[model samples]
Target: CSSCKESLEDQCSSINNEDNSTINNLKEKLSLISNFQEINLEKSLTLAAEVGTALLQENDELRQQLHLTKFEKSFSELELEDQLEESSKKIEKLINEAN
Candidate 1:
């Protein structure tokens, strides 16, 4: 009866040790998961900031391009008007001379 009691005590002790080891492993895994989640969140925020900056830059560039295009169109219209006036004057002079 004493031997049976000793064996049972040893088995219970072994089971307790195994349970402690399993708990320790689970705690370590939880800590690692928390660290990984934090790192991922930081990386996502950084990437979002970078993307926003790039989009703003592109918007500014497009605005400048639109301004330049408008100026070019206005200049062309003025040039065409001047050419038409010169042609009209030349035709009038020719008609007067023929008369």
Candidate 2:
């Protein structure tokens, strides 16, 4: 009976030790997952900021191009008006000479 009791106690101890090891491994895995999540969050924030900056720069460039196009259009209109006025004066002069 004593020998049987000792064998049971030894078996119980072995099982308890294995349970403790499994719990420790699970805790380590949880810690690693938590660390990875934090890193991913930081990377996501950084990427968002970079994309925002790029979008702002693109917006500014588009606005500048729009302003330049408007200025060119205004200049072209003025040039056409000048040419029309000169042609009209020439036609009037020719009519007067004909008279």
Candidate 2 global lDDT:
0.64
- In the range 1-99, model 1's lDDT, one tens digit per residue, is 346446555655665565556556656655665676466676567655655665565566556556655765676688799999999999999999999
Model 2 clash tally? 0
For each candidate in turn, the TM-score is: 0.58, 0.59
For candidate 1, what is the TM-score?
0.58
For residues 1-99, write the lDDT of model 2, one tens digit per residue. Answer: 346446555655665565556556656655665576466676567655655665565566556556655765676688799999999999999999999
Model 1 ranges off by over 4 Å: 1-39
Give candidate 1's whole-model lDDT. Answer: 0.64
Candidate 1: C-alpha RMSD after superposition: 34.1
- List, in order, the clash count of every candidate structure: 0, 0
